[model samples]
Target: MKRLLAVLATATLLVQLGTTSASAAKPVRSSAIQWMGHSWWPRSVGGAPGPSGLWSPANATVDAEGRVHLRITRDRKGRLVQGELDTMDNGWGYGTYRWEVASDLTAMHPEVVLGLFTYGADPAYGHREIDIEASGWGRTPITWDYTTWANGHNPVSRTPVVPGRSTHQFEWAPDRITWTSWDATGALLATRTVAGADVPVPYDESIGMNLWVCGCTSEWRKTPATEVVIDRFSFTPAG
Candidate 1:
């Protein structure tokens, strides 16, 4: 009787150990909006069918390492699905928003757009926006564009996309907004600044990050399914 009891106890211990090991090996996936204090787009709001794509909570997740992964793919109906996370409230006056791109933006399909921007369009407050968009079209060269839009003035600057892991940032001030791209080693790849009248004035808007397909461009619609991984995102209030 004692020998049988000992054998059963040993078997139970082994099972427990195996369960622990398996749990440790699996990455934990959590909601990106809840973890990062952002909101999923196009769910309750009505808008045009293409730019925002179809946002799915299942498409946005935070891995075990706390990195946010935004995936873009197609559903069974051949509809393009994407991921988007936006802040809950306006960023107020001036501040800096920074995030890291874990995927190779330069290698993405031309139709794919990784956007970091401030969005607001209200007639009472006037429209205001600032954007840093990275896009590629099939085998063509990838490009990054920094754009600022207001009621009357909208300016854009284009540059070659930087490949590999990199940090991208946008610093918004009262006078100017600066968009910068840097590699993993902290070496700056490109910088674009919009100043004077082109800068977006004070308005109520939330910062957002999205991985979506551009439907307006006919060639962009040809891109295959892809993903965009984000290592981190932070906001620093301006002094």
Candidate 2:
């Protein structure tokens, strides 16, 4: 009888241990985002029905048929550059975002790009910024040039995503920004702060993706048909 009782006690202890572990596991969360539009970029000029970056008018709307296009070029020495113009103006713009990188990716070189024309002229908004480039080989590191001004200066924050395979969530709020990355079993790899900056003035100017071809030399090393696609994008207002 004592032996049987001992066996029952061991089983009970195991059950309790399991229960504790289950409770210890962290929870994962995703953002509440709504899709505004869906568009695809073509690898070639003639492959799809789209407007070339050269033809982007004063105000343009990206359609569902993969028609919106940006002109990409290689310099004399072969480098990637944004075409001739900065298409973002009054009506053309981008919304703010909260994002999370998937944890399952062993390596990711995530980047956020904003389009502004400043080729021969002064920097856009009279300032420049480059922050947070992580975990990619041979890719451009996160970098930007910033110009300071009076009253309220520009400030920015970069959020680092953990390295592992898991689904993560990102939320951008005025008071605080939240991020969570979890594994297949829903174990949190890392949850932390996202880098941000405060605008000195009211920047009502629009933002979009723009680049000049000759200004960049990195294209020589990259292959053709190398197009960067922003798979998902959205915005959430501060509360």
Candidate 3:
């Protein structure tokens, strides 16, 4: 009887260790950003005009390596989902913003948009905004746009992005804004410059990034589970 009891205790210890090991092997989910937030916008609630899709923190994650992963998938109700992050500071001014696309964006559906932009008010208020968007725009894949709001001015570019990492940057100055995209090899893919009257000046807005479906419908985004990884993001204020 004593030997049997000892063996049972040993088995219980082994089981506990196994459970602990399994838990440790699992990847840890990150905490939400303090200054950044996300939202879920349904199709009925003025969806197509803005970041026009559903968003949840569960669809965004920062791994131990500090890479931000924005995922798009279908929910249990068959609704298309996406992810967004917006800075809490609404006092963003003239500066340089840069982001590295760590995933193969070419693999994503044409309707999938990876946007780096700034937003203030609605367009009716002559809202000042700038965008570096990668999307199919209801066409083929690997299309990009550098746009300025308030005037519907956008320079479209069709550049084949390599299936890896790349860089996108914009410099917002008081007189002009420059947008550039670079391939993984550090080669320039496309660029757009807007100056003179087209430059959006003296506007304060929050800088944001999102991975969303264009029309919140499968007609644009055929893939159910899509993701965009951002390796790094930085902002430099003007001196």
Candidate 4:
């Protein structure tokens, strides 16, 4: 009888251990925290940036001064981790999406692509993505690129990004998307409007901001860590 009782106790402990293990593997959820009047959630993903990359929630934070800061860091496992945030809710459409960037764009890491734009899951409704990226493509002379993509067509406009704090904007309207950027002293750096078939209808896309390694070249396989700060992000509805 004693041997049977011991076996039952062991079975009960095994079940409890299984329950604890399942709970520990669950994903973390953040819904109460809001930044810049928008609910943003950080990603914890792998299998990106050529071969592999990680997005750590700790690498994305908002300061007491109300600035959004994104960084690339290393995890406890010695793997490279970066910051990427997306709005929790979708359908921010047909308006002016603007941000004030505090990072100096003249000097940036060669493999880094600082992206601020909209993304959609479905390819049929919207174009799936629009990007305002600051990248050097793993080389010198980092510049800002306004890219519009739809139906396998991708068009990009490159422009110089100045030093100090600057403002960037993309106004999505009925049939066009106008992109603009300014220098620290309120001087316009770039402006262009993209229309025609490549323009998306702003159907079901959400805002996203990420500081990630560029997969455009072989540089994504290297080790690099950096950060970018944004003063604010605002949206003005179309009139």
The best candidate by lDDT is 4
For every model shown, what is its TM-score relative to the native structure? 0.75, 0.34, 0.74, 0.83
Task: Write down the lDDT of every candidate, Cα atoms only.
Answer: 0.62, 0.27, 0.62, 0.70
Model 1 stretches with alpha carbons more than 4 Å out: 1-32, 36-46, 49-53, 123-126, 137-139, 151-155, 216-221
Pairs of residues clashing in candidate 3: none
Rank ordering of all candidates by TM-score, starting from the highest? 4, 1, 3, 2
Candidate with the larger TM-score of 2 and 3? 3
Residue 34 in model 4: shift from native, Å? 0.6
Q: Order of all candidates by lDDT, from best down to worst?
A: 4, 1, 3, 2
lDDT of 2 by residue, 1-239 (tens): 00012332232233323333332211100111122442211111111011221212211223364322334444455543332112112221222332222222233222222222111111232322211122222234422212122113332322333344334343434333344445456775455543344221223222223321211234323423122222333344444
How many collisions per candidate?
A: 2, 21, 0, 0
For model 1, residues 63-86, the per-residue Cα lDDT tens digits are 788777777777788767776665
lDDT for each residue of candidate 4 in 7-96, tens digit (9 for 90 to 100) = 322322333233344322223232223887877766554434333456777777888998888988777776668787767666778889
Q: By the lDDT metric, which is better: model 1 or model 2?
A: 1
